[model samples]
Target: MASKPGILTEWPWTRLGSFKYVVLAPWAIHSTYSYLVKDTTQRDLSNFLIFPMLLSRVLHNQIWISVSRYRTAKGNNRIVDKSIEFEQVDRETNWDDQIILSGLLFYLASMYLENGSHLPLWRTDAVIWTILLHTAVIHPFAEHIAYFALFSIPMLSTVFMKNISIISMAGYLTYIDLMNNMGHCNFEHIPKWLFSTFPPLKYLMYTPSYHSLHHTQFRTNYSLFMPFYDYVYGTMDKSSDSLYENSLTRKEEVPDVVHLTHLTTPESIYHLRIGFAHLASEPHKSKWYLWLMWPVTLWSMMVTWIYGRTFTAERNVFKHLKLQTWAIPKYNIQYYMKWQTESINRMIEGAILAASDKGVKVLSLGLLNQEEGLNSSGELFLRKHPQLKVKLVDGSSLAVAIVLNSIPKTSQVVLRGKLSKIACSIALALCQGGVKVYTMREDEHKKLKAMVSNEAGHNLILSQYGTPKIWLVGDGLSEDEQKKAPKGTLFIPFSKFPPKKDRKDCLYNSTPAMLTPKHLENVDSCENWLPRRVMSAWRIAGILHAMEEWNMHECGNMMFGIEKIWKASLENGFRPLTTSVDPKPN
Candidate 1:
């Protein structure tokens, strides 16, 4: 919102929230139904085109947003180094409103225009001379006048030029929409050679840096799509060319650390930092509209498979260290497939090798990317490339510390789940700390007993009888087993993913995560299922390893000191969250 939001700042559908598009549903359905039902010769093409035109504009803008965000996060060829706060992102969310408004205005104007339904896209009618004359005379006035006056261009052009067509006006509006998104994309993509080769092109085309100056300076470079008028009136920014040149010459940044992760759900793609602005800023969940993009989701999966490379999901700076989050193209479901095991390991190995070659100090695996069943928690990567310098971490130690700290100071806690390294570590640590670890199954107890000492063995008792208030859980925690727990039992998860909330009566703690330090820059998006600005213990473990200049690998069977990591986290300004869980309606 603006300092004081008014009609200009807020949209008419502001109160509708996610269902704001419902306002356009009637028009869309009617147009789609009409177009399909009617014969080509009998169809009202102009009316039907309006709805699809709006959709095209939306798709066009979204392409710019996703590409711009992905490029900017990579920090290569970025125009403005200034951070785009959530306020800017939230404001940009409504860029579609202009598209909707333009379509509506075009439809209204078509009603009055001569032979509007049969207007050709372009005709070398005598209207060109009139358009040029009006642009030269009325353009400067419109630029200085109220912004709403800019809307008068299409109306004024059509009123004067009888030969002008709706399609031609529509084409002009599309040009405006394209230039608007491109100017604010915050990246330099236009080649400088074009302007040098044709000096006149400099006056005709405005670079991203040129418009960036108008936003920062607020008094220069006011031209909408052309720099010609701005130059004529002495409003062109002086630093525009310099910023453009420097932005183009900017070098690609090599991060100090990288976190390797993968997508969870089909909708998880939209939750990425480079995806939708509103969706990315919140905890990941299935949006009602995502089902409508089933085709896009499938297409994205295919594209990822074909691309066969990692992409930057997020980038951040903590103190002097540059951190990046790179995601493998595979999804959680694909990782569980036997057919995908070799392919998945190959990608992980490639990423590790690339990070080592780039002089990255640490690279951490997240989500199913580090599963023991898949790669023995990243153990396979080391066997293939033992001489790599980049320290690979599974982040299990910090995750263990966070889960341990989240548990209340109870004498006994129920431990249940499929046996994993994290779960085993938590059970043994609790036992060694004199906390009784009760197990329900004999097999799990025997497996855990083999991993612990005789002194701590007594603390690990086989009994599911008591109503333990604290339950240390992991994957394979079924709803029926959850029902067995007493009401008000606090379930603390030791895994990367949270369990399904089956018992409302039972309290569920989120997967291990901690509040990020204030100095962590560019933290606009939440990690999957974690609260806003809260970093998962596993993700933070890699960052800590990099910052501490640790020269050891924490992946595979290797481990770090739990207390050392926990103490370093606090010392480095990373605070603990009291509780983490999937956000639910009150």
Candidate 2:
């Protein structure tokens, strides 16, 4: 015998709750059509034919709410618990905002398609001419001007006048919202055989079991209308069927409420995971060494083929500290050289995937990962994985913070690098701190000199100034040039390379240089706790600082100062690590 449909899964009238909506639906449609169209007699016949479809839109929310209430009242304890958990997770993560945005996009697409047919056949030539004029003469702004003049202004006037367009738009938005809500309600009474026999039906309408997986495991099944978008984006969860079955059939009692925040315990804390294109200690630039490692590289490739691209190092967890780290291994330099364009990107994507799997909140790019040609503040990763929940951070602000704090007040310093974004930020901070800065870049030096000279009551001269007390060598400086600094000068190198042992002239090294294995060992007893392996820690700290102070969303390339870093650390419940101080002014 076929089991009867549950209250939530019954026929359309029962699911809709009130019979009053059914009775009034015909009258509502006729009234709306009569108000909008002049020829009521012709439109009334058409409206009568499509009255059911129009009525469905008006009562969608009411039906959804009725079904939801029925399910909550009749479902087992475990089912109710799962529903509550889903709601909590949705609220805490702000997933509803994303849903609304996606719905708006769908609405815009619908509007565009509808508008394309609204014009008459005779007006097609005029439309083409207008497009050509916009393309050739107006260029980029042409589209913006056309959209404003043609659609936006007219739409505004119609909305203000309370026309048919306004009524239709409201109905469309409400329909979308109700459909999205319906997709989330996990009614277990849906027949599996219906979906199994007609797979394409799943694309047009979501089954309760199908949409349940989206709430539980958020990295997949993003589309509300159909599975088509999910399939195209490669974000459809394969285990959705099994998971849904377990949710429906499980006998064990589950917790009534499960917040996503509660899941972030010490054991499952979202790691600030970091990635690198090449290790700092490795000889990445040497072609001969790279070729020599080809055999080992081939073996690694076989291993990757068998397992996967990413190889995870043991998790680094500090007992007292709330922070943890995960390092994802990438291909060696040989593979990168052989497949120059694709190699590093593949490694980066693999690392990001691994981090996302581990539930990482923030993934920081290290050293070579930030190279202009590579990830470049993780724009590529973001573009490729629009469904990715993990935040990508470049850690530029943290690097700047460390650099600024290292310099003393009123000290004269020489900057050895082309005036890059980071370098410019450092220069601005130095000037604010009453420090005189000299630069190796002649063009930038001239610009700085002129600016300083032009300032009223300032008597500082560039060429006539005495030797700088400190020399700060950035990533652009070569090893040979670093060795040429004057004797007894306080040399600070920002690049990954360590200073020579025989260099007795330099007084101190910055935090970036201290990330080396040897230097880290001297500072802490954890010889295996390689700081250089996770150099993005500095950047993570810096970005967190910026976020706290400025409420900045993207921190990939933003500049930060020491004051902001210190305050941000205090706010975020962590202490910023202090490095060795420079020598006192002679």
Candidate 3:
């Protein structure tokens, strides 16, 4: 006697076994409605086809399974082997499965609508079936597709199949399947809003974030069509939204290490520690007041004093081709400020040590870690820790790359800061790219003009007379300076305050906080998640640039120079700020 085939071995075709009844039930109802109410002459012979289809479906599945097993034994079918391996890891219904499931439900609904018109009872049954099928099957399948494809497919299918009704439901199902496959292949172009839409469509349709939870640790989000089922059944996972947002915006291309520090203020730290204490004491049942309890605060403070040294949290390894992250923890913001250089250096050293220990290739500095000036350029850290082989990235190049990339090439870019080495480097790069560059810093203007004059003596007229759109880059613009900018002037903020609401047409926040997981998670709480997304894009671009160099030379030092770094940043996806001014004027 042979052993029975497990559900894992059967899959898609096996699904048909249970699903055939779903198809048959609708068909049976329609057949009865047609025979008794619609007309005696009109009989639904389609209902009888269910038994044969089921038998055929089983045979089809068994054949495929046998073939797959045979091919695996012979080692000639990599696709089947890979599918098996994938099943072991994921074990979830993929795009194809979703398509079949959605299609069956659509087909069932179409039958019900087509037959139930004559009887009031049958009409009610049709409505109930439609709701049940949508809630139980279509919604969950749509969600699965959304999470995997980032909400691109279902949105597209909805638009493409807008005119499709019960009469053309088959065509609609086919369109959805086609669009889903296409979206899965090219999901990067899908708009971010599709993923971040409020009241998340996980239950009604699908949401990337909601679906992402199903892929990750939580498996309770089992409702396919609408989250209502999950909520009603108490199977809804609360953290799905945050996890999904993190998946979309976080640097998934490069191996990223999150350098986290405690909140600076003693009061804040006390509160945070107390919160942690409460969480520990009550596990998932901790109350809000527990975080403010004096006993909890005292215990937290005592624990911090005893063993709050910088440490490494768990190395978060993502599944399905996602980046691996090592979360490096440090003291609060105020601790570094109070101790100054020594504390900062210790934190930097700890990050490096932890990263090196975990075999992390690149170490990303946390917020304000670049401040206090210890390893702002990573030159100091490299010099101090010669033995450590990890590359130190302050995320400045990536940040600058993102700002330049966001500004349209047609816009005239103004570098407003005093001509520091970094600013000069940026200005020079812009000039070389042939951007019509301007500057508020007179000294830097003179230097840039001289450099431009020296580089393009004859081409100077091109820059002088070009009709370039003006832009302003600074910490923040003064009220007087704000008046100087044209109505549509774009403001790119570096370190200074953000532009006033009415001051600029658009403001780009290139701050490091935009890229932090904490900020990305709180996207719903703010007016926009664009800044955080930009940060994430920049971080990914920088990491990719580093990855390419590291892969070739086993180190990212190749991008140490300003020119090399700038060029690599451009290649990694940041569009060049400067365009070749047509010396021959139009």
Candidate 4:
């Protein structure tokens, strides 16, 4: 939205939401009906293609949006080097409005333009030209002509051109969209040597840096695709060439810490920073409307199977320290599959080695990537590459600290579900801290009692008897068991993924997390199920590991001092969440 929004600034079909595509459905159906029922000579190919072409434009713009957001976040060759806050995201969310407007205009132009139904062809009929040029060597020549129509002679609108073939029109429209997206993407991919080879090309084609000035300065460099008009009107920005040169010379960013994570669910794809802005700004959860996109979601799952490499999900800077987040292609369930163990380990190993080569001080394995069953909490990578420079962190120390701090000192805690390293550590710490730790499972109680001294072990009770209000839960906590808890019982989770909330009267908390300091920049979105500006303890631990300049790796059987980490976190300005989280249960 602009500073002062006015009439027509928003699309009339805005209230229609996602179903706004229905506005073009009648034209599409009528065009198809006419093409199929009419005689061969009377069939209008241009009119029939209007709907599909408009849809293609929508998809093209979407590709640019995703790619631009991803690239800018990575901070490689960025033109403007400015932050894209939630306001920028909301303002740009309606980028497809132009495509919708053009589709309606295309319909009206077909009725008023001369020979609208039977326009002249380039060399032959559209059908033959499309086939011969696509199958022969003339496709490149036709694209050059389209570029001329787009860059040199910008007045030629495909919707109004009476002397254009359908094939040439498609090419022209594609080239125009490609250039338009490139100019506004805020990423510099054009090389400086290209201008040196052909100096006149600088004025003919616009670069991202040139357009970035138009956005920032707002008074000059107003040309759309070409800078020729700016040059003619003497409105060309003075720093265009220098900015382009600087952008080309810029290098990719190097970070002090990297958190390696994976997809939590199939629907989490939409909650990525590179995905929908509205969804990313909030905690990740399933949406009812997402079921309508099941086909696309399924396709994305299939694509991830083959996308074996890691990708940058986010980048943030706090004070003098730089941080980054990289995501493995696998999902949460995939990490549990026995067959995927080897492949998953290979990906994690590769990412660790890559981060080491890039001079990253610490690499943290987040979520299921540190599952003991998968890689022994990242010990396999250490064994394979013992000489690696980057320290691997599982963040178990801080995770347990958060769980211990969350339990109310007055309430007895009922420890439930599958016992793991962190669960055992939390139980041990609570016993030492004089907090009663009760277990529903007899085997878990015996295992925990045997680990501590007789004095501390007295606090571990083996029974489902007491009605403890504070429940320290882990994965595999059944819904039936949760139904047994008292009303208003608070369930604090130690596991990475939270448990299901089966009882309405019972309260649940998000997995171990802490409130981030105001110094963290570009934190517009929540970290998975955690609340806004509240980061996962594991993530904050990695950042603290780098900031404290700790050289030791915290993976395998190693456990850092919990009290020390807690004090360091508080001293570094990462506060505990004052409010309890109650997100929709998984």
Listed per model in order, the count of residue pairs whose N, CA or C atoms clash below 3 Å is 1, 1, 11, 0
| Highest TM-score model number | 1
Q: Please provide, for model 2 over 245-318, each residue's C-alpha lDDT reduced to its tens digit, 9 standing for 90 to 100.
A: 66567442221111010011111111111111122122222233345446655664555434544322222222
The local distance difference test score of each candidate is 0.81, 0.45, 0.41, 0.80
Give TM-scores for every candidate, taking all chains together and pairing residue i with residue i: 0.93, 0.40, 0.40, 0.87
Where in model 2 is the C-alpha error above 4 Å? 1-308, 318-328, 331-339, 353-359, 383-388, 418-420, 443-466, 496-502, 513-536, 539-556, 560-562, 570-581
TM-score of model 1 relative to the true fold?
0.93
Candidate 4, residue 316: CA error in Å? Answer: 1.2
lDDT of 3 by residue, 1-586 (tens): 1298554444355446424335445554555566557555454433333334444443343334333332222222121111222122133323135434443543353355443122221223333333333332333243344443433343233324332223232232333443333222211222457646854544455443454455454466665435667777777788755544544454322234343333332333322211222121121222445444667456656675556565322122212211232222334444345555666567567766766775556665544455524454455666666777555655555544445554554524656643433344455556667765665545556676676556632222312221333443544345665556555455555431234545645334333223323212211111112221233322343354444544321112222344455466445444433222222111
Per-residue lDDT value at 224 in model 1? 63
lDDT per residue (tens digit) for residues 1-586 in model 1: 2587555555778788877777777766776697789887777666677777788778888899899989988888898767655666666677676666666555665556555554545566524643463354222342212443564565456555665555655565566667778899998999988988999988877888888998899889888667889888899888988899999988777999999999888789999988898898888988878999999988998888777588888889889999999999888889889998999898888888888998889999999989999999998888878898999999999998888887766788899998888899889899999999889889999999999999999998898564687888899988888888877788888878899999887788879899998899888888998878899988999999988988899988888999999999999998877854422311
Better of 1 and 4 by lDDT: 1
Per-residue lDDT of model 4, residues 388-505, tens digit only? 8999999999998988887665535789877888998988888888888888878888899889999999888887654787788998988778877877788889998888878888
Q: After superposition, how far is residue 357 of candidate 1 from its true place, in Å?
A: 1.3
